[model samples]
Target chain A: MFEERLKEVQDAVEAAMQAAIAAFPQSDLRDAMAYAAQGGKRLRAFLVLESARIHGLTDAQAMPAALAIEALHAYSLVHDDMPCMDNDDLRRGLPTVHRKWDEATAVLVGDALQTLAFELCAEPVLGDAAHRIELVKALAVGSGAAGMVYGQALDIAAETAATPLSLDDIIKLQAGKTGALISFAAQAGAILAGADRAPLAAYAKALGLAFQIADDILDVEGSEETAGKRLGKDADAGKATFVSHLGLAGAKARAAELVAEAVAALEPYGPGAEPLRDAARFVIARDK
Target chain B: MFEERLKEVQDAVEAAMQAAIAAFPQSDLRDAMAYAAQGGKRLRAFLVLESARIHGLTDAQAMPAALAIEALHAYSLVHDDMPCMDNDDLRRGLPTVHRKWDEATAVLVGDALQTLAFELCAEPVLGDAAHRIELVKALAVGSGAAGMVYGQALDIAAETAATPLSLDDIIKLQAGKTGALISFAAQAGAILAGADRAPLAAYAKALGLAFQIADDILDVEGSEETAGKRLGKDADAGKATFVSHLGLAGAKARAAELVAEAVAALEPYGPGAEPLRDAARFVIARDK
Candidate 1:
């Protein structure tokens, strides 16, 4: 049942995102943006919709925020895949923006996509002006220099450091890089409703770390075809990850523990948050 | 007198922007962002402050919006100077972000700076929630897919096109690339006051065009030392510019006419708009 609901969100978000891109004038830049945003699992959007649903908000009311997170995610991937960054050729089962178009187009595509994310956050249907401004501010805090970008900078710095990062350092880096955005998505519904966000924020904190651990595990064991991107990159670069600090078996155990923690954090909402509970379980169990 | 006012705005904005960047954790990314944001003419910020002043808003009230525009402008320059974009080495009389740091750092600096721009717009001191949302929305419209980026995409496309851009085509491109942001800055005060924005919008439209014409003229006739960057690149690449389509003298005359139109549009404010009139004159007369 949860899988079906997740699929529904994925389809809805994909269509809505396409419609948003279509509103722009036809050009290579627009085409590149559409291509870059095309196919993600939409986990971030799912998190947004589920959290909103638990808060008595309908899909239509929360769709803009969902799209905003996904757009921001897409922009990060586009820049991360650039020749000067990760130098990856594949993303979401197709050529990365830099590969399909050129580097310049890719850069503009990412820049424009980031702008689009903030633009979507200000959509009127979300709520009152105060609520929308709150969303915008929270998003900026979650994604800007102190958030995802900070984590990215740390990751790059780690690459050339004299020593591999310690376990605690890795956790700090991941918290900024991925945890911040996930926390923002999960807490968005509460922000929109002006309700207490502590429980959802806690749930997201554990879930985000678990998600990263799973990604590292996948990099070690998952098939490239299944992941739809390059695998084994971390091991190839000798970068320290959760699996590097803890053995694979230990890493899996820790992730399961995090999933349990995530599930417990949703107890405040009881059965109304079943979808989110299921999402926590799926984070570590999925092959990809 | 106008130069002094402009310099004062520049210094205030520079200090405020530095303080904002300093809040982020120290890293190459943070350093590069600070470096890239330093030393602009701050023309957009001046327009924002001047317009706000005309609307009875104080410098403290309008400063956030002004800083927001300058931040957005800085991000655009950082991305535009990347190896994959303009491949520029010099910006504002200093080494470009990518040259001083690495390509990855430059790209992330631009991304984070863009996020900072939106963050600044949401500053509570700017206004009430509704007014802040309006500023954010207008800024997104000005800088996103349909505005500055669209103009940039067109310029890149033009580089490899079979034919050079015509006079009308260049104007359309310039309007999107530079005019949109200038319009946003100029109209911000009216938006904050919930007043009619038509007059300021008109002034900005003409002023933006004149500014582009001046840039093109500088490319053709100004020295690289004075311009603080490469000159004659347009002619070297055989790109169509105002000076190419309308000869140097013709371009100068057209710029003068546009300045008059910009000044005339400000007649609604009568003598209180003298500083803005002087700004228009400065657009065409300045060496850089």
Candidate 2:
């Protein structure tokens, strides 16, 4: 049931994104944007839709926020894959934006996609003006200097640092890099509904950590074809990860614990939160 | 009077931007962002503050929007100065972001600065939620795929095209690349006050073209020391510019005419718009 619902949300968000990009004039920049935004698992969108559904809002009401997060996520990936960043040639089982076009196109596509995220948040259909403004503010906080970008900077710095990062340092980096956006996604519904975000925030904190652990695990064990990108990069770079600090089995166990904590955080929402709970479980269980 | 007021606005916006970036943890990324944002002419911020003043809004109410446009403008410069784009080594008489830092830091700094722009728009001091959302939406439209980015993509394409860009193509490109943000800055006050924006929009349209024409003229006649960046690159690259298409003398005359149009657009506000009229004249006359 959760899988079917996830697919439904994914389809809706994809269509909305396509429609949004379609409004721009035809160019390689636009084409690269569309390409970069394509083929995510849409887990973030799922979290948004599920959270909104739990809060008694229709998918239409939350669609813009969902699309916004996805666009923002795509932008991050496009930049992260650039030659000066991760230097990845592949993303989503296809050539990354810089590889397919050029670095300039990738940079512009990412920049424009980030702008599109805020634009979608301000869409009238999202809600009242106050609600939309809240969404925009939250997104900026989640993605800006003190959040995802900060984390990315830390990661880059760690690469050439005098020593390997400690476990606590890794946790801090991942929290800003991946965890911030996840928290924003989970709490979007509460933001729109003006409800308490504590429970969802708690849920996302654990879920995000678990998601990162799983990613580290995937890098260690998952196949490139299934993961749809390069694998074993962390090890090659000698980057400290959860799986490196903890044994593979121990990392898996920690992820399970985090997933359980995530599930418990959603207890306040009860059965209505089952999809989110399933999502938490799926984060660690999936191979990709 | 106009020059003094412009300096005051520039100082205020610069301080606000510094304070905003300082809130982030100490890192090279933050430093690079601060560096990239410093020392622009603050023309866009002046337009925003001047427009807001004309609409009976206080500087405090307009400062966020003013700072927002400058941040957005700074981000564009950082990205545009990259090796992949314009390959610019100097900006505002200092090394470009990528030259000062690594490419990754430059990219991340630009991305974070763009996010900061939207975050500023959402500041409570900007106005009511509705007004803030309008600012965010307008900013996104001005800076995103259909606006500045679209113009940049067109400019890049023109570089390798079989034919030089026609005069009409240049106008269309400039309208999106530079005109869009100027129009947004001019119209911000009316958006906040719920006043008609036609006059300010008209003023900005003319001023923006004149500004570009002046830039072209500066590339030809201005010294590298005064311009604070590499000059003569446009001619060296054989890029079609206003000076290239219309001749230096013809471009100067056209810029003068547009300045007149910009000044005329402010007739609705009588002498109260004198400062803005001076700004129009300054756009065509300034060395940089």
Q: Which candidate is the best by DockQ?
A: 2
| Per-residue lDDT of model 2, residues B56-105, tens digit only | 99999899899899999999999999999999999999999999998999
Off by over 4 Å in 1: none
Instruction: Report per-candidate DockQ.
Output: 0.90, 0.94
State the lDDT of candidate 1 residue by residue for B1-288, as single tens digits: 999999999999999999999999888888888888889889899999999889889889989899899999999999998888888999888889888888999989999999999999999888889989989999999999999999999999999999999999999999989989989998999888778999999999999999999999999889888778878889999999999999999999999999999999999998877888999999999887
**TM-score of every candidate relative to the true structure:** 0.99, 0.99
For each prediction, how big is the interface RMSD?
0.6, 0.6
* lDDT for position A165 in model 1: 94
Q: For residues A1-288, could you state the per-residue lDDT of candidate 2 as single tens digits? A: 878988888789889899999999898888889899987889999999889889999999999999999999999999999999999998989999998899999999999999999999998887888988999999999999989999999999999999999999999999999999999999999888878999999999999999999999999999999989999999999889999999899999999999999999999998999999999999998877
Model 2: reference contacts kept, as a fraction: 0.95
**Model 1: per-residue Cα lDDT over A1-288, one tens digit each:** 988998999999999999998999899999999999998889999999999999999999999999999999999999989988889999888999988899999999999999999999999999889989999999999999999999998998899999999999999999999999999999999988888999999999999999999999999999999889999999999999999999899999999999999999999999999999999999898876
Candidate 2 lands at a TM-score of 0.99
